[model samples]
Every structure is written in C-alpha cells, then in structure tokens.
Target chain A: MSNPTAAMLVIGDEILSGRTRDANMYHLAGELTNNGIALSEVRVVSDDRSAIISATRTLSETYTYVFTSGGIGPTHDDITADCIAAAFGIPIDIRDDARAILTKHYADTGLELNAARLRMARIPEGAELIENPVSAAPGFILGNVFVMAGVPSVFQAMVAGVIHQLSGGRPLLSQTMRFMVGEGTIAEPLGALAADFPDLSIGSYPFQKDGVYGTNIVVRGSDGGLIDAAMIRLSNLLPEVTDDPE
Target chain B: MSNPTAAMLVIGDEILSGRTRDANMYHLAGELTNNGIALSEVRVVSDDRSAIISATRTLSETYTYVFTSGGIGPTHDDITADCIAAAFGIPIDIRDDARAILTKHYADTGLELNAARLRMARIPEGAELIENPVSAAPGFILGNVFVMAGVPSVFQAMVAGVIHQLSGGRPLLSQTMRFMVGEGTIAEPLGALAADFPDLSIGSYPFQKDGVYGTNIVVRGSDGGLIDAAMIRLSNLLPEVTDDPE
Candidate 1:
C-alpha cells in the first residue's frame, strides 16, 4: 500500500516577513518521512482569517493527514484555533479538560491562569486535545487535521505525543551516489535507469564546490533489493563514481 | 497603495522526502520584503505535473506576482517548463535564445551540448528569459509568474534580475522590543496596543532562556513613524525591557 499522504500548513506573518526562518516545516518534514507518511505539500500563509480557514479545509480534504503550525498563542494575533473551528463549522469554547491541564501546570509554576492565558484552553467541538509537554497549552486533532503550535520546541513535543497514533506504510529508503561531473553529463543514462526501475524514484541534485560542478544522484524506494539493483546499474552507467563530491 | 502581493511555488520531491531542507523560501522571503513586495503565501509541491500546473494557475490568479523555483533542469525530473505552459494552455518548445546561450556556455566549459543538455533550452511562448549568470539554463517570466531555477545561487541571481521590474509599495519596516515576561503576562495590554495601531502589526514571540520565560514583541508596518510609536507604547505596557532574552 502507498504511504499515507500529508500536507503541512505553516501560518505566520513572521515567516512571510522574513523576521524568522521557519524551523517547524523542516522538522515536520523529517518526522513525517521517517514515520512513512508522504508529506506531499507545504503551504506558508500569513495570519489571515479567510486564508487560514480556506487552506485548512482544502488541505484536510486533499491529503490523508493535515498538520498545521502557528497562531495558537495567548496574544490577540493568535487565531489558529478559531480558524480551525470555523473551517469545519464547529462550535468552540474554553474546554474543561484543557483548562484543567493549563490550570494545574500554571499553578505549579506560580503563574496566574489569567484571562489571556485561558484563551489557549479553547477547543473545537468533538476535537481531541494533543498534549504539549514543553508548554501547558495543548494542540488538538479535529477530524484528520493535526493543529500544533508554531514554536519549534512545543510543536516537536506535540508531534511526539501524537505520531504513534498515525498509521504508516513502508519507510522510504534512499541511497546517494555522487559523480564529479555536472548532471548534464549523465542525464541520459540516469533518465534511462529511472524508466527501467519504474518503482524507484531517481533524482539528481547539482552542487558547486571548489569551483567544480558535481551532481549527487539519489535513488529512493520502499524496496531495498530494487534500490540496491538500481544503484549497481547506475554505477555501471557512470564512467566514474567519485569517492567524494565535497 | 498596498504592496504587490506575491506567492512562491517551490517544486521538488527532494524537499518532501526530507532529503533536502528548503533554503530558497527563506532567501526569497527576505529579498521580497526588502524590495517592498509582500510575499503573502508560499507552497511547496512535488515534481508532479498536475500539482505544479494547478498550483501555478491558482497562485497566478490570486496574487500580484508568483515566483516558482525548482524542477527546471536537464534531468528527467525537470518538468516545470512543460507544466507551466500546460497550465496556461500555451505551446512550449526549444527557443533560439535559450539554446544559443547554452551552446556558448557549454562550449566554454568543454562539455558537450548533448540532447539532455539541450532540454534546458525549452521556453514557453510569450515568455521573457530571466538570465542565469551562474548557469546557462535560462529562467522565464510568463505573465505574472516568474519561473526561476532551484539552485540557490542561480535563484538569487534570477530574483535580482526580476525584482526591479515589479512595482512595489512602501517597504515594510520592523522594530523589536524584549520584555522579561511571558506573552500571557502582557497579552491584554499588547492586544490593546495592537488595536490602537491598526496600521502596524504587533506580534509576540515567547522564549525560555536560562529557565526564565521572556517574550520579544515585534512591531511591523509600512509607516516608520507608526512602528516607532507602537514600540514606545509597547515599552510603557511592559514593566521591564530586558537588554537580552538569551
């Protein structure tokens, strides 16, 4: 069976404005790949209500799983929870279970459960809360969409909390072979090899190091034997396989 | 006038497979921000034909400008040019200008301008070529979409060549203030402050450094005076303005 497909929706003005380089997308990409889920698409949109709601609905419907990060904060600008609720036409309120967790955690830290802090306790109707170990604020799963915080540490913790529940297919395996030449030199043979394999994905990444252009051929597939066989054919096709491209 | 809103479509399976972390998105974000073009949305899709075509159409219609990177190469996986043409129902084939550039570039480098390399010469009808100083493979501009190379150096050069042509509004300026408190501590006043300055965007980024939770308030706007005023109001709201959150 094919791996479950997923899409990531990264919501933040900081990212769009270039104030912050997003760490969450890269993190989730790696995590999802290892879990055997194919992360097919990623979208980064600013903190706009209509944009968020539309993107969430589209991604949730298209992919098997949809993971969203950011905008679930205490400040006024944090509107991810509300957008998620609006996307599914669900009623949301300060949930008792979520509030109880935040209350105990803040109390332990000697911080007040102020009105602003309590804003995080809001959950959509019929949604299940995902635990956040780093912060008391909980992420949630409404339908197939996984709503997590944008903060790197908190998003990571939430992913760990929920990853095991996701059913995965065969983990995609990759093998990289580097040649001390540009992709143009081996494109024909590489293309032919890709066609022959049919099942494996063959991609080339070019780089310039010390003023020399080289290409790294990455062969990826679920089957180890097929990947190994393709790599052997690739080696025979190339006149020379460089020990290191760097 | 509002800045020309833009979207980015990053095409690559390597990114989705977690083999490569995307660098182009961050680079373009900073460049567009400095150029006074508002990059509102970004989508990273794989090297699938339908996905690329559909994304191109949607982004082109929605935003003032759409920038696409990757999948424009000599190798088999390079399908962006064909996909872009198909998206607009335009014909694409080997154009003289692109082929001539490649011929000279390869002749100087002592590499054969073989059939695989010649694939780089394809250009959609009615598109203007974007010069790639790093490589001979020319990117193009078709209507609102600026199709560029995926390689960082090449992508940067293409952006620099095209950025001046795009009509931009006021450059969005930003100022940051650090408070030795969590966002929850100052959310009420911060929210009120954000409401006060409707022109400026006030955002809080919380951090835990040395076991102390602190928040960084970032004020962004097109008007420098308004951003400055918001910063002043923000200082008055918080009790302590820490020199550093680290």
Candidate 2:
C-alpha cells in the first residue's frame, strides 16, 4: 500500500519577512518521515486570512494529512484558528473544554485570563483538541487538518500528541555510499542504476570539503534487501572512487 | 507604490525526506527583503515533474517575481529545466552558448564533456542564462521566474548576477523593542497599538532565554518616521518592562 501523503502549511510574516528562520517545518518533516508518512509539499504564507484560508483548503483536499503551524497565538496577528474555521465554513467560539484547559494552566501560574489570553480557547465546531504539553494553548484537528502552534517547542509537543493516531506505511530506509569522485563522473552510472531499480529513490548530493569534491549517493527504498543489492552494485560501479570495500 | 511581491519554489526530495535542511529559502527571503521585494510565499516541492510544473505555473501567475532553486544539476533527479519549459509551453534543448561555457570550464580541469555533463547546457527558448561563478552549470531566467542553482555558493553567485536587474521598491525598515514581560500581559495594549498603525506591521515574538521570558516587539514599515513614532509610543506604554530607559 502507498504511504499516506502529507502537506505542511506555515503561516507567519516573520518567516516571510526574514525576521525568523522556521524550525517547525524541518522538525515536522523529519518526524513525519520517521512515522512513514510522506510529506510531499510545504507552503509558507504570511499572516493573511485569505491566503491562510485558501492554502488550508487546497492542502486539506489534496493530501491525506495537512499539518499547519503558526498564527494560533494570543496576539492580534494570530488569525489561523479563525481562518481554519472560515476555510471549512464553520462557526468558531470559545469552546468550554479548551477554555477550561487554558484557564487551569494560567490559574496555576497566577496569570489573569485576559481577553487576549482567552483567544487561545477559541476552537472551530466539531473539532478535536491536540494537547500542547509544553504550553497551555491547545492545537486542534478539524477534518484532516491539524492546526498547531508556531513556536518550535509547542509545535513539537502538539505533534507528539497526534502523530501516533495517524496511520503510517512502511518506513523508508536509506543507505549512503560516499565517493570521492565528482557527481559528473557518477551521473551516467547512477542514472542507469536508478533505471534498474525503479522503486528505489537514488539521490546524489555533492559536497566540497577542504578543497576536495565528493558526492554522497543515497539509495532509499522500503525493501532492505533491494537497497542492499543496489548499494553493492553502486560500490562495484565505482570501485576506485568509492570508500566502501567490495 | 506597493513593494513587488515574490514567491520561492524549492524543488528537492532531500528536503521532504528530511535529509537536508533548506538554507536557500531563508537566504533568498532575506535577500528579497533587503532588495525591497516582498517575498510573500514560499513552496517546497519534490523533484517530481508534474509537481514542479504545476507549482511554477501557479506562482509565476500570482506573484511579481518567482524564484526557484534546486533540481538543475546533471544527475537523473535533475528535471527542473525540462519542467520549467513544460510549464511555459516552450521547447528546451542544448544551446550552443551554454554548451560552450561548460566545455571551456571542464576543459581547463581536463574533465570530459560527457552526456551527463552536457545536460547542463539545456536551456529553454527565449530564456537568459544566470551566471554561476562557483560552478559552470548556469541557471536561467524565463519570464519573471529566476531559476537558481541549489548549492548555496552557486545560488548566491547566480542571484548576484540577476538581482540588480529586477525593479525594487522601498526597503522594508524595522525596529525591535525587547521587553521582559509575558506576551499575554501586553497583548491587549499591543493590539491597540497595531490597530492604531494599520500601515505598519507589528509583530510580537516571545522568547525564553536562560530561564527569563521576554518578547521582542518588532515594528516594520517602509516609512521610517512612522515606525520611529510608533516605537516612541510603545516605549512609553511599557516603560518598566522595556530595556530602554525613560
């Protein structure tokens, strides 16, 4: 069976404006890959309601799972929850369950639950909350869309709560063969090897270190035996250049 | 006049597979911002031809400028050039000028101009080559899309060749005010400040460093005087929390 496909939507102006480098996308990508879910695409849009709504709808319909990060904070600029509701044509209010979680968490810290703080309690109708262990604010899952916090710590915690529930396929396994030769020298043979194993994804990544050029050829597939066989063939193809023994 | 909007399309499977963290998007975002071009959106898609072609078309039509990085190498996975041509309904083949550049560069190193190496010479009709000083493989520009190499050094070199040609608007100026207060404590007042200055973008980013919680309130706008005025008001509003003294 084919692996479940996923797409990520990152909503923040700080990312687009170059004020902050996004950590959530990279973390989630690694997490999803480990979970045997193929994260096919990632879209980063600014904190705009229309853009968020449009991207959410498109990704939700196109992929098996759609994960969105950011814009779910207490600040005025946090409009992701409202946008998610608008995308699904649902009404959103301060759901009692979400409010209770936030209220208790804030009360324990001796912080007032002001209007801005209460904004975190707003959730779309017919949605399930994704618990945030690091922070009190809860992420929510509406349909296939999982809405999470923008902060790296909170996003990671929320993902941990929800990832185990999703169905996953065979985890993709990868083996790397490092060679001192330039990519140009190995492209032809690598191309041929790729054609021979159509199911495996063969990637050539070039690196320059200390005035020496090298390529790391990665062979990835679900089947360990096929990948091992392909690796042996690849090492044989470049006997002198490969670092691995025959 | 509004700043010219831009979008970035990162074409790579290594990114989706969690093998590589994307550095090009962050680099380009800062470059575009400094150049007065508003980078509004960024999409990271795999090396799939259909995905690349579809994303190219969508971004090209929506934004003033579209920058694409990766999948322009000589390996089997390098399909960006072909996909770009397909997106524009243009035929691509080995152009003599591009082939000559590669041939001369390789000849200096005593490397053979094999078929795989020659693949870099393929350029779409009516496209101009963007010089890669770091590597011989040239990136191309078709319409408003500036196709760049994936390697950081080569991509930066190629961008330097073409960035001066694009029309840029006012540079986005920003000022940051740091406070050792919780975001929830100031959200209501910050929201009022945001409503007062609709033209300026006010963003509150919370950070916890060495067990101390703080928020960096950033005011961004094209007008320096307005941002300065807003900063004064902000300092006045949060005298005790702000690092700045009254």
Give the best candidate by DockQ: 1
Candidate 2 on A35-117: residue-level lDDT in tens? 88999999999999899999999999999999999999889999999999999999999999999998898888777888998
Cα lDDT for residue A54, model 1? Answer: 100
> Alpha carbon lDDT of residue A200, candidate 1?
88
Q: What's the lDDT for candidate 2?
A: 0.90
| Candidate 1 residue lDDT tens string, B75-125 | 999999999999999999999999999999988877789999899999999
The interface root mean square deviation of candidate 2 comes to 4.3
* Model 2: residues with Cα > 4 Å off, grouped in runs: A242-246, B242-246
Alpha carbon lDDT at A63, candidate 2: 97
Error of 1 at B213 (Å): 1.8
List the RMSD of every prediction in angstroms: 2.0, 2.6
Candidate number with greatest lDDT:
1
TM-score of chain A of each: 0.96, 0.96
Alpha-carbon deviation at B211 in model 2, angstroms:
2.3
DockQ of each: 0.61, 0.55
**What shift in Å separates residue A1 of candidate 2 from its native position after superposition?**
1.1
